[model samples]
Target chain A: MEIIISILLLSGSFFIFLSALGIIRFKDLYSRMHSTTKASSFGLLLLLVGVSLFFNELNVYVKTILVVVFIYLTAPLAAHAIAKSYREKDKE
Target chain B: MAINNIVLLLSFSFLIVAFILAFVRLLLGQGIYNRIAAMDLIASIVIGFVLVYAVFIQMGLYIDVAVIISLVAFLGTVAVSIYLKNNTNKNDGDNH
Candidate 1:
């Protein structure tokens, strides 16, 4: 069980690393947002789940679950707003 | 125990790599939007790192910190987007 948890966490970390690479490598604003928002959001969610899995304590699991929920609710909207602003800037 | 520690260390290293990637965008980004986006990405990653750290260190407090960080980042992104929108409009007016 511990090994499984570790694997999940590492996978999440790997995806985060990939998104970061995408942020640096992508040519433009929209594409960068595309990579970072979705990839990192999923990565963080997985990481949080891994944390909950590893820590059998109820409070820790609850907190980690909250973090996951918070990210889910916020990340996409933030990225969209940012991208919209950038597009508006381009039009001007 | 040894393997777990190694995995944890590697995850931290991955976070560092993410930071470096964001730093590259900060330095070489073509525009203010790009830089701001990079900053936003960094903030999100930091929150993830905090959550992971909380798990590794077995602390519940860091989760609260992560939540606070997320809230701050959301507000910061909104403010920045508004400012960027207004600033660009002002520039357009000046050019006319």
Candidate 2:
């Protein structure tokens, strides 16, 4: 159990690190948005999973799942809004 | 026990580094869009931080904080985007 939790947390953090790197290194605005939205969402998923496993309680499971669902739902919407506005501004 | 502690430490360090990188992008990014995207990324990183801290201390309360932060971040992003769109339209209208 300990090993599993540790692995999940470490990998999640690594993915987040990757997301940040992409934000800094990606050349184009759209590409940077792409990197930030997808990678970070996955990273958060992993982190929440690890937390759920570590706690192993009903309430923890529920809250973690709620957080995961909320994040997955909103991250893309936020990205889309930003991208749409960006393109519109660029057009003008 | 020792390995778990080390793993937690390492993951926390990773998150810290990620936060710094995102902050740099937010500060130095070229355009408004770049900064907005970086800000979103930073919010996600902060969520990660909250989760890890919760695990580290074995408390469940912080997960609620995570949810709230995510909510705020989403709303802020959408609001900024809407404002940007409206502001651009106003500018174009004035010019034309």
Candidate 3:
């Protein structure tokens, strides 16, 4: 049980680190947005799952699931807004 | 138990590194869009930090904090984007 939890947590952290690295290293604005929005969301999902597993409780599972769902629903919308605005501004 | 502690510590270190990298991008980014995107990334990273801390201390309250942070971050991003779009439109109208 502990090993599973640790693996999930560590992998999630790694994905987040990769996203941050991508944000810095990517040359274009759209590409940076692309990297961050997806990678970080997935990382957060993994972390939440790991946390829920560790606790093994009803409330914790519900809370983590809620957060995961919320993030999944909103991340792309936020990215789209940012990208759309950037395109509109670029047109000027 | 010792191994679990080591894993948690490593996870925290990774998150810290990610946070610092994102901060650097926020500071040195070229434009408003880049900065805004970095800010969004930072917010998610903060959520990760909160979750790890929740696990570390064995408390559930921090999860609630994560939910609120995510909500605020999403709203801030959308608001800034709308503001940017409106500003562009106003400028275009003035030119016409």
The prediction achieving the highest TM-score against the true structure is 2
lDDT of 3 by residue, A1-92 (tens): 88889999999998999999999999999999989989999999999999888888898889888898899999999999999999988876
The positional error of residue A50 in candidate 3, measured at the CA in angstroms, is: 0.4
- Model 1 chain B TM at 0.88
TM-score of each: 0.91, 0.96, 0.96
Candidate 1: list runs displaced more than 4 Å: B1-3, B94-96
Q: What is the lDDT of residue B89 in candidate 2?
A: 98
lDDT of 3 by residue, B6-54 (tens): 8899999999999999999999989899999999999999999998998
Candidate 2 lDDT over A36-73, as tens digits, reads 98899999999899888888889989988888888888
- How high is the TM-score of chain A in each model? 0.93, 0.97, 0.98
Clashing pairs in 3: none
Model 1, A1-92: lDDT tens digits are 88888888898888889899999888888889999889988888888778777766788777777777878888888888888898886765
Model 1 alpha-carbon miss at residue A15, Å = 0.9
| lDDT minimum window of 10 residues, candidate 3 chain A | A51-60
